[model samples]
Target chain A: MKEIVVVSGKGGAGKSTITAGLSYFLKENDILVDADVDAPNLKILLEPELIREEDFYSGKQFKIEQDFCIMCGRCYQECSFEAIEIVNLNYVIDDVACEGCGLCQFLCPVNAISVSDKLTGKKYVSKTKYGFNMVHALLNPSEENSGKLVAEIKKIAKNLAKEQNSSTIIVDGPPGIGCSTISAISGSDILLLVAESTISGLHDMERLIELTKNFKVKRKGFINKFGLNHSIDEKLVNLFESKEIEIVGYLTYSQNIPQYLKKRVNLPEHIDGYKKLFEGLYNRLMEAVG
Target chain B: MNISIVSGKGGAGKTTFTILFAKYLVSKGKKVLINDLDVEEPNVNLFLNKKLDYDEVYIYIPEHIKENCISCKECAEKCLFNALVVAKDFWLVLPELCHSCKLCEYVCKYSAIKGSKRVIGKIGQSFDKMLHLLEGRLNIGESLTTALIKQVIGKSLKIKDNYDVIIMDSPPGTSCPVIQASKDADKIIVVAEDTPFGFSDFVVLSDMLKEIGKDYYLVINKYIDGEGYSEFASKNNVKVLGKIPYDINLAKNYSFGDVEDIDTIDFDNIYNTLLEG
Candidate 1:
């Protein structure tokens, strides 16, 4: 079995676009994983039919009960996050800022604090329109612990792949070199970085490459929207080569992307050069992973 | 007042629109401070082309004193983040996993843990006396995005008196870091697009803004002909701010130094409208 995670350090660098295209092209008993919990958009492209949805509990949130409060303000003073604030003569914890350290709960003089399991996110298993199983997640907006959610969804995808007796899982990763990106690509066999040919793209790509350098995974680079600037494109190619990452494919700029985006269509499969681009990438990826 | 430019999706031109407003405010004889809270990869200085002086943001990760340790694993057992891996002889601290909550240091019975600061990111400051840009760039392989963002906010707040307006460019996704940046803003301008993914995510984003009690305006970036962005904004009960047209020439030339013609986006009224209210 092989798992290939597509990541781009910068968002909107065509990570999901490329992953959806590649997954649709290789719709042969492969399990698709959408690990962008904060903004999971793969289902929009694939129109996945939900099979099951489950609540995900990652951490506990501490809340102060106003009824039992004496309002000593000790928690407000001791909190590092400043999550506790005086509200209507009672201290309240801002869930967004609260680090869930439990220090405030321990310090409350009247013991007005209570801890409860936080519903951090939700996990879903579904069947894509392409007849392949898909595992995805959606983190509650303004929630933390996305890395944990990504790891959980990846595990579910792996388990589903095992049950379906599939050998390949195409994981759509999120942006930023943060916990979610790390979790998505950590154990994957092949890491395909889909990057654009722009200065911001190049700079962030270098950081993403640096982040994944310690992991023992075969790395591949695909410069999506390449050929925009010859110099920038060339620089990206050199950066990829210097990292010893195989240059699997180069997708030139295509107007079909935004036009199809207007038509609410993802996976620019019918564009002039997309078929060749994705075919070359898929072939190179399989060979490299094998 | 501080305004945060945020987006549900990436490449919605959040930075582009922010620069337009900041530059426009400066042209109007108003002082502006721009804080790039997109710490994972802060590139505001790239477009401004300014030589910035940077200060490192320190995050305290525990430094274990192995000699003072009893292998009781109390520190490891009490860690909420599981950052401490208690080996057969010593405890290993995975700096990436550490949330810097000071819980491990608090629980160490043998005084085995010491507080230490590591550079997780850098805040770059640049200005031309009228417009100041604070670029918060997270160090490579670091996931302490919210910590750096808070630091950037802190640094920018100290200089808030110098500027007539403070504009923050927030990171993508409706996550904790976004909330951290959004909570401090007087107004949040959500730069979105005219696609299903973009519109749906904007809806989700507005729900978050409501939960955080923030008033937001929608600016559909890359506005094209026959897109239902205005309709979507109205349906969602969001105020339409302004739209930056889709121009390939502008995108091609975006790599060059400073932006010159931000008025083409027709954002002259937003400054007064958002400020006066």
Candidate 2:
């Protein structure tokens, strides 16, 4: 099976809109994965029906066994994250500050700290109305294991694709060039970035391109809101020319944005121009994967 | 006062609103320091007139000394980030994946694990008498985003007394990096729109802010009719701080990089709540 990851270095560039569109277009013979665990929006568009669910534990956390406390203060000095603190004359570990390092447990002279896996996020395998299987997740608030959760979701998507005998997998990625984006794009066959036509858009897209190149992945892109600024649009195309990233599509802003977004429109069924636009995007994708 | 502008979803105009708010403060004769903590892609400098260049910032990682190796796998097993690998004859440490938490050093009984510096990103600063801008740029393959963001915020706390107000432009999402940026802020302004994705993501961050008990306000950036976000804001007991109408010319000007002295969008409520109040 082939994998395609969609990412944008800048937030609010409409990466979810494009991913939803691609998922609707692919329909069958493909699996969709939402790698944007922090704030997944594809579920807003596709409306997937839950088929399977699982709790994801990436790292470990420590619990203080107060019954066997000595208050030696050695755990406090040995802690790397400063999670160990004495509150109200009682030793406790702040859940927010803990990195799940398990060092406090090992260094506890009284063995008062016990290490256990922490629940950071949840994963779901669902079926969309379009007859496509989807894998998505939601990282709990203030959770830091998003990179691991992303990798886990992608692994499930790959296994589901193999079981269903599908030939393609599309990933909706999180914005930024951090660990989560890297996990989404690391081994993907195709990278498609949807960049807006603004100054910040170009700047963030340059960073995205640099990140993709670091992973040795050739990225192709589409410019959202092309007519907003002709000069900047040309500069974007010129930058693509310089970087050797092909420009496969250009999408313009329309009045139906709010109207369409309100409906969570993923399919191009109602929009006239999008049918052709999605076809063009899919065609370029097919060509690249082939 | 240091206020951080954050959003759970991307393209919600965090950078746009931050720059506009900074400009408004400068016009009001308040010394401002704007720090862009979105090290993954620092783009606030794109709107500035001067060239943006950053000095390299490095983080500590453990480099294994083979002669002192006992191969007990203690360091490898106790690592918090799973960055170390132990083979029968060799050790592999992935520097890019390290969190620089230094847990490996504490676990080592011997002094085989040596602390070393690796370039993580670049931190840039530009200033005049009135407005100062500091930006963090993470190296392309670097994974230590929260560390660099913390460094920028940590340093900002030291020299913040020199400026009347400091505005932190945070990265997208409600994760570690965004939390790190918001933890130190006096107040947070979440930039969002009146859409489903925007509403849900805003609620996510709002819940987090409420849970953490941090002072925060909501700003609607691209409000068409304010149907979805307004409902969410009212339901959540959050005060609506400001609103920017969805206008094509404003977007065009932003695209063309011409956001100087243009008062197309009114930020009066925001100014009153954040500055005057």
Candidate 3:
């Protein structure tokens, strides 16, 4: 089995739109994984029927007992995260800022602080409307450690692929070259960078290419929304060529694209050229991965 | 006062709106300081044609002292982020995983660990008279986004007296970095594009803002004819700040890094509305 992960360092560059379209065209039995835990939108396109969900726990959070607490202020003084804040004359942990480092628990002289598992987010396994098993995660807003959730969902998708004898795993990765993007790229056979033909898109894609150098994964570039500017599109194509990345295909600009996406309609049926574009891109991807 | 421009969906014109609004404020005789908190990409500098003086930003991670090593695995065990690994034969440090919590240095009994500053990103600032720009740009492959944002914001606050308003262009998404940038903002403007994926992510951002008790207004970028943003706003009781119409020329100008004042948004009216109470 092979994993083909799609990432665009800049968001709203048609990563999910392309991924959903290609999933419909790929002939192989594939499992879909949405690695954008902070903003998972693959499910919005390929509506999923949830099979199971479970609480995902990672690290630890400290809870201070109000009765046993003496406001010694030691935890506040020692916490590097500044997570311990005084609220209504009571010391409370700001879960958003808390890094769960256990420094506060160790520094508390009153023994009022107790450590418990931090409920980070939820993991879901479902059957997508595209007839593929999907695994995705939703990290609570303002939560850290999104990379962990991405890795978790990818792992679950891999195991499910193994059980169901799937051939390919299509991952819709998050924006930015952050921890989550790194996690999504890990162990993937081919990293398909879905970039748009704009200056910012080109600049962000360059940063993402720098990131991919750390891994030995084969890279493919597909410029979405191409033809917006001939100069910018040429610049993007030159970038892909200079980086030795294979250019799979390009999708020209379309106003109807967003309209179709807004209505959650399948793109192949409504969008003018996306049907042929995705089919050719899917074939090229399978060829590259193999 | 600090007002941050953010959109959950990137490439949804957060940076474009920030540049245009900053120029608008300057035209109105408001000394504006623009803080580009989108460190991962930092596109504000692209549109602003100015030479900036840059200062390197660093984070201190535990540097192992190989000469003083007793190979006691205490420091590795104490590391919450698992950035350090010490065995009898070898020791390693993955700087990317290091959170810079200083726990490793604190736990080392034999002085086998020392704090060392590594350059993770840089802050660039330039004052063009009334319009001051401070931007944070993370080095490629670096993951410490929130740390750099915090430092850039700290520096911006120090020089806050020079400007009448500090407008922060926050990073996209409703994540840790976004939370850190929003922590100090007096008002937040969420730019939501009129698309399905855009609205989906916008709803997520709105939920996060509500959870954090931030007073935010929405601006529909690339506004279409029959979108649900207005209805969603009324249902959620969020104020509609202003909408930038969907113009292909605006997008074309953005692609070329040109910032010309367009009649698409009535910035003066929005400014008046923002000033109320």
Candidate 4:
């Protein structure tokens, strides 16, 4: 099966809107993955029904056995992270502060500290109204290992696609050029970059484009809110042409989007021209992916 | 005092605010040290038109000595991250997956395993009269950001007590890096816009700060261009430090590296409120 990832350098660039519309346009049984584990909103638009949920754990946490504690204060001093703190008379480990580096566990003369797995987040597999599978996750607040969660979500999507004999997988990736974005784009057949028309937007897009090039993935560009600045839009078009990246389409500023977002409804149905625009974009994307 | 300019979401003017804040402090005759903790994309240096002086930060990972190796497979079994793959003749280590826990070395029965250091990223520092900007740049294709952030923050700690005010520009999201940067702060100013996205992320960030026991104030940016953020702030009982109206000239000048005068605008009031808070 082929996969396409939709990513933007900055937030609020209509990445989820486009992903939801495309998911609606794709044939039934296709898979949709929301790799934005932090603050995932694709389900709000797609309105997926819960099918299954599983807890995911990436790293371990250090726990000290109080009975064996000697109040040596060695763990506090040796910990590179100030995960340990003195509460009352006993030392306690702040699970959030603890990096699970094992230095405290190894250095404890009393062998009081031990590492155990902690739940980081939960992943969901659901059935959307469009008759497709949706795989997404919500990382716990102040949790780490988002990139690992992204990988797990994609793995589940791939397995679901195989089990259902689906032919395509579309992913709504997170913003920023971080480990999570890299995990979402890795091994993808195509990447759709949705960039805004602002100076900082252009600069962030440059960094994201450089990042995508490192993975050697085929890329296409779309200028979201093209009406923000006409000159910047022209400059972006030229930049795409110079880089040999195709400018698939442009989306002008529209209140209909935020309206749909507020109501948690799909765009194509609520907006007047969004359906046609997305249908055409979907067809073109299929052709390009082929 | 160490102050951090942070937002829960990306592109919310963290770097822009840092530069302008540095210029404002310099004009006020206060020495400032700006540390950019957004190691994944260190763009503060780019805006300043200065190259970073790089110093390597190393992380230890297990390496097997072939001569002393035993085919026991104990190291692989003890590895929780699945970083060690035991083969018939030897074991292979996946450096990226390794959390540098040193468990493989401890579990080795043959004394074959040894820990070695690898440079995951570098700490870069540059200085002006009023500002000493330090940034950590994680090497491309490297996934270990928390380690690099720790190194950068550790190095900055030595000189942080000297400066009158050390301003830190943190990475987006309430993850490990954000916690690391905000851990030692005297106070935090969360810069957010008046939008659903901004408000939602602000709640998440506020919860994080409260859990970590840090004192914080909120600044609603682009308030003149929109509304709703104030309502959210009031309903949540988040202290309002200040507000910056939506101004194209301010944004343009900031993008071009000309620090717009915060005193000429309402930002000075915002800074004063934060200082008071």
Candidate 5:
């Protein structure tokens, strides 16, 4: 199956809006994956009903056996992460600060610390009203390993596609060119870059484009809120053309986006202009994948 | 003493704050080192107008040697990221999927797995009399930035003793890179705005700081007239270090790399408050 990931370099670029609209245009059996584990909002627009939920564990959680503990401070000194501390003549492990690197457990003279798995987040497989499977997740606040959660979401999406004989997998990737974005684009067939027209937007887009080029993925651009700065929009178009990247569509600035957010509805329903633009962009993506 | 200017959300004026802080320190005749850990979009150089000297760094991933034919599939089976796929005759390593943990090399029974380095990106540095700038750039397709950021921070460590204070402009979000940049900071100033998104992310960042035992203060940028941001500050029990009102000329000056001319408004109070604390 062909997979397409839509991502923006920074947040507030109307990525979820475009992804929601694209979901409406995709085939009935295609799988949609929301890979933005930090702030997964595509499900809000799609309104997927949770069919299955599972906990995602990435690393170990350290627990101290207080009975065997001596306040030698060896674990505290050996821990590079500063997870161990001496409190009231007893050593304690702060689970949140602990990366579970196992340095303390190995170096502990008393062997008071033991590592165990802890649930970091929950992954959900849901059924959307659009007749497609949607896989998304929520990482606990301050929890690490968003990249690993993103990979797990993709795996579920791929498996769901195979089980249902789906033809496409649509991924709404996280913003930023970090580990989460990397995991989103690593194995994708095409990358759809949704960029804005602000100065920082342009700067971040250039960096993201550089990152996408490294992965050697076929890329296209969608300029969201192009009217914010026409000059920057034109400059971006020129840059994309010079790089041989296609501009799929330019979406004009409109309050319809924020309006849809308040009403918790899809873009195509609230804005006629966006409806047409999304249809065009969806068709172009299909053709590109074809 | 490396200090990073960070916030939990984007558009919190982190770059603006960094530029202003650098200028403030420069005006005080103190040598400062500014490293833009925001490799995804390094804009400090745009405001500084200084040329950068770059050095490339590579993240090594182990490639299995085919000659040592042990198709045990141990590497693939033991892999948590599923980056290695072992076929009946051979194994394939997806470099992009690899997290560079080097666990596969350890799991190989036949010693066939060996690591090879691929240059993912470069860390660039520039120097002015007032400030030294180090910026990291990830290769266009490279997925791993934590490694590159580590390199940038590692290089910045060498000159920490040279300057009285090292200021870092960190990337947005509370991810690994952000954590890495803020790991060794003596103090963190979270630049936040008076918006709901900004408030939410500030809370998340505050939780992280509290957990990590890092002392932090909040600077509300673009403080409007009668906005009651002070009340928010009071409720959170975080001191409002200083406020820069909404000024178009100040923003324009910053965008054009002329921040040094914008009068240092309220920075003395902010710095004093930090120093006193």
Candidate 6:
């Protein structure tokens, strides 16, 4: 099966909207995955019903055994993160501050600190209202293991695609050139970037393109809000021209799109011209993947 | 006062607000330092249009000294990030996967693992009149975002006393990086667009903020007469600072990187209210 991942280096550049549109257009042929585990929003567009759920534990967390009471501040001094803090006069590990590096546990002379598997997030297999299987996850707020969670979700999506004999997997990726974004795009057949026509958009998209150079995947794009700035649009087009990335689509600046999204209406189904636009996006995607 | 402009989702106008507010402070002849903590894809310098002095930032990763005789897998076994691999004859340390925790160096019984510096990104600073811009940019293909952010914040904290107000542009989402950026802020201004994804992520972030007991206010961007965000802010007791009307010209100006005197909202009032109250 082929995998197509949608990502935007800048946030709110319409990655989810494009992913939702692509998934709707692909229909039964594609299994959907939302790799933005921190804030999964494809569920808002697709309206998936939970079919299977699983708890994801990826890293280790150090827990202080309160019964073993040696107040040696060795662990506190050696702690690089300062995760070990005194709360109510008891040396406790601040869950938020802990990086799960297991240094405190190793340095604990009294063997008071023990390590346990950290439940970083939860993954779900759902059946969308539009009749496609979707694999998504939610990284527990403040969890740093989003890259692992994204990799796990992609694995599930790939397995589901194999089981269902689907020809494609459309992934909605997170914003940025961080670990999670890297995980989402790696090993994908195609990388569909949704960039906005803004100065920051061009700047961020440049960084993302720099990131994608390390991966051996086909790069394609749609410049969202194209008419917002004609100069930036021209610059984006010129940049796309310089790079190997193909500009397959351009979405004009629209005020009504956000309004429609706020109401949870499918763009292609409700909007008059979006049907053709998304159809073009899907067609270009198929041609590239093929 | 340290003010952080954050967004629940990407592209929610955090940078836009940050530059606008920084310029506003500059107009009033206040010493303003803008910290762009969005290391992964920092774009605050795009609007600055000024020459910035650059400094390379590095993270330490363990380098295995191959000739140290023993093949004890203690370092590999104890490594939480699984960055180290021990083979029969060779050892591999994936620098990209390393969290720079120095655990491997500490765990090695033999003096085989030594810490070495690897360049992660650079911190750029532009002192343009009253406005100072400090941007942290993570090297492409590098995942150590929070490490660089910590460095940026560390530098900001050292010289923050010279500035009247320090405005930080935090990366989007409610994750470790966002939390790291918000942890040091005196107050946070959350920028939200009035869309479903925006509203949903905002709810998630606000809940996390409340759990963390962070003092934060909401500013609606590209607002289109929407009561959903305002109602939720009221219901959740979150302060709604101001709303930026949906103006294509504002977007256009931002796109052109010419935000010198673009006054879309009452940034002065917002700053005064946040600082005083």
Chain A of candidate 6 compared with the true chain A, TM-score: 0.97
Over A60-119, each residue of candidate 3 has an lDDT whose tens digit, in order, gives: 888888899999998888888888999999999998888888877777888999988889
DockQ, per model, reads 0.62, 0.70, 0.72, 0.29, 0.20, 0.77
Q: A67 in model 2: Cα distance from truth in Å?
A: 3.7
Measured by C-alpha RMSD in angstroms, how accurate is candidate 1? 2.0
Chain B TM-score for all candidates, comma-separated:
0.94, 0.93, 0.96, 0.92, 0.93, 0.96
Per-residue CA lDDT of candidate 6, range A1-290, in tens? 89999998988888888888877776674699999888889999888999999999988888898889498887888777778889877899988888889887877888999888888789999999889889999888887978989999999998888888899899999899989999999899999988899888888889888889878899997899989988889989989889967899988888788778878988887776998988898988888999
lDDT-wise, the better of 2 and 6 is 6
Clashes by residue pair, model 6: A11-B10, A11-B11, A12-B10
Candidate of highest DockQ: 6
Per-residue CA lDDT of model 1 for B175-232, tens digit only, reads 9999988887888899997666677677778888988888888888777762667666
Per-candidate total of colliding backbone pairs: 0, 4, 0, 0, 5, 3
Colliding residue pairs in candidate 3:
none
Give me the iRMSD of candidate 4, please: 3.3
Worst 10 residues of 2 chain B by lDDT: B260-269
Better of 4 and 6 by DockQ: 6
Give residue B179's error in model 6 in angstroms: 0.6
Runs in model 2 deviating more than 4 A are A214-218, B51-53, B260-268, B275-277
For model 1, residues A1-290, the per-residue Cα lDDT tens digits are: 89999998988888888888888665557798988888888877788999999999988899998899887788888787888988777789988899787778766778889999888888999988878888988899999889889999989888888887898999999888987888888889999998788778888899899999999999999998787666788889999999888788887776657777666565445564666767778888999999
lDDT of 4 by residue, A1-290 (tens): 88999998665566877888888876778899999887676776677899999999878888988999999998888675677988888899988777666768867899998778889889999988887889999888778889989999999999988988888999999877778989999989899998877665676677788778867678999988676666677878988888889988888855445544555677676665878888887877888889
- lDDT per residue as tens, model 2, A13-81: 878888888776774758999999999988888878999999999787788888998988877887656
Q: In angstroms, give how far residue A97 of model 2 lies from its true place.
A: 2.7
Q: Interface root-mean-square deviation for each candidate? A: 1.6, 1.6, 1.2, 3.3, 4.5, 1.1
- List model 3 lDDT by residue over B89-126, tens digit each: 57888999888888778778788888888999899989
What do the candidate models score in CA lDDT, each in turn?
0.83, 0.83, 0.86, 0.78, 0.77, 0.86
TM-score per model over all chains: 0.95, 0.95, 0.97, 0.87, 0.76, 0.97
lDDT of 2 by residue, B16-86 (tens): 88888888888889899999898898888788765655678877888888888888898888777778998
